[model samples]
Target: MTTQPSPSDPAAVALELERIRRTIEVGFTRTDGALALLVQRHDQTDEALKGHDRRIDDHDARLDTLERGETERQKRDIARLDALERARWPLPSVAALVAVTGLTLSLWQLAAR
Candidate 1:
């Protein structure tokens, strides 16, 4: 058998229904606001990441330029050193002969004494 609700129960049921409706409305509004904030945050994060990537690319280009300059300078320095060494190559042999002559003269004088 189907039971019909009493008139006194109708008022209580209406009040409960109104409360449920208000709760649902508040929940949907809060969720919508949260979703909007999340979308804004994601857009900002994407822009910041793009900026960081661009800066990194610029830094890499600068580093490559500096390395090329350094390599050129090192090559020039090595060439200059090589030229200096070539210019001085004969001095050591001349100095060695002079030392030997001096030693022979000293030994001859000692033997005569």
Candidate 2:
């Protein structure tokens, strides 16, 4: 429906070239806009990833603190258990003394009777 410029006409050729230049300019503009948007999105994603890294680091620190506390608690519990084991070591000696006392008392009572 449109008339195109003849290649032989200087003015028409100039006009056609101008039109092509404009079209190329528009394409470049659109590409620039898209590239700008991509760069912005990449920056935002970078910030988000940095934030996640900070959170992960914080979680790791907290877990390490909890582990250290638990390790200290386990050590204390082990020491207490060991001390209790040592305390029970004299039980057999006390039991033997009670048995000997009971036997001596029974023998003395029989002699008196």
Candidate 3:
């Protein structure tokens, strides 16, 4: 027949078990702190991405406005050019006018002389 352990040995075993429980609690606390830090970093990253998206949308709106302005300017330039072409006047034919004026001037000079 075997003898049972004494009460003093059981007390020692209880102390050892308490120490192990404390160690596990400290490790879990450290892990909780690290997880909290990671969550904070993720939140900051999300905010930064939102800011970037807003800036991109602003740029897109500005680009659309610029395109509309360019189209309007081109239309005005084309209309002005067309008006200028339509308003142009043709000059008289040079050779026939010169010959007629020369003959009239020579006859007038002979009559004067």
Candidate 4:
């Protein structure tokens, strides 16, 4: 930009305008190149993030499967424990036998009296 020019210097003003135009063209080229690099980097980042998301989803599914398997195993273990407990105590049969023995003792004591 020519700030001031003699009235008789149209050619100089034109030349200054041309120089400014060329400078602006160069700046635009640099800006375009920088923008293109940024776009390329952004695309690469997006692809990487998408891959990570897929991996995370797969991991989550695997975890869910493992949890389900663990739950089933726990249920089977609880069933086994319950069977063991029943075998150990057999509460109903034991209670009935105890009551009958106590009755027999009481009857014997009455008879003796």
- List clash counts for every candidate, in order: 0, 0, 0, 0
lDDT of 2 by residue, 1-113 (tens): 98876779999988888999999999999999999999999999999999999999999998997777666777898799999998776878989999999999999999999
- RMSD score of candidate 4 (Å): 4.3
In angstroms, the error of model 2 at 64 is 0.8
| Candidate 1 global Cα RMSD | 6.7
Give each prediction's root-mean-square deviation over alpha carbons.
Answer: 6.7, 5.1, 9.1, 4.3
Q: Sorted by TM-score, highest first, which candidate order results?
A: 2, 4, 3, 1
CA lDDT of every candidate: 0.89, 0.92, 0.87, 0.91
Model 4 weakest 10-residue run by lDDT: 1-10
Residue 99 Cα positional deviation in candidate 4, in Å, after optimal superposition:
6.1
How do the residues 33-111 of candidate 4 rate in per-residue lDDT, one tens digit apiece?
9999999999999999999999999999989877776667778887999899877977889999999999999999999
Q: Which 10 residues in a row give candidate 1 its minimum summed lDDT?
A: 2-11
In the predicted model 4, the residue pairs found to clash are: none
Better of 2 and 4 by lDDT: 2
How many residue pairs clash in model 3? 0
Top of the candidates by TM-score:
2
Q: Write the per-residue lDDT of candidate 1 for residues 1-113, one digit (tens) a residue.
A: 96665657978789778999999999999999999999999999999999999999999998987777666777888799999988876877889999999999999999999
Off by over 4 Å in 1: 1-12, 70-113
Q: Candidate 1 vs candidate 2: which has greater lDDT?
A: 2
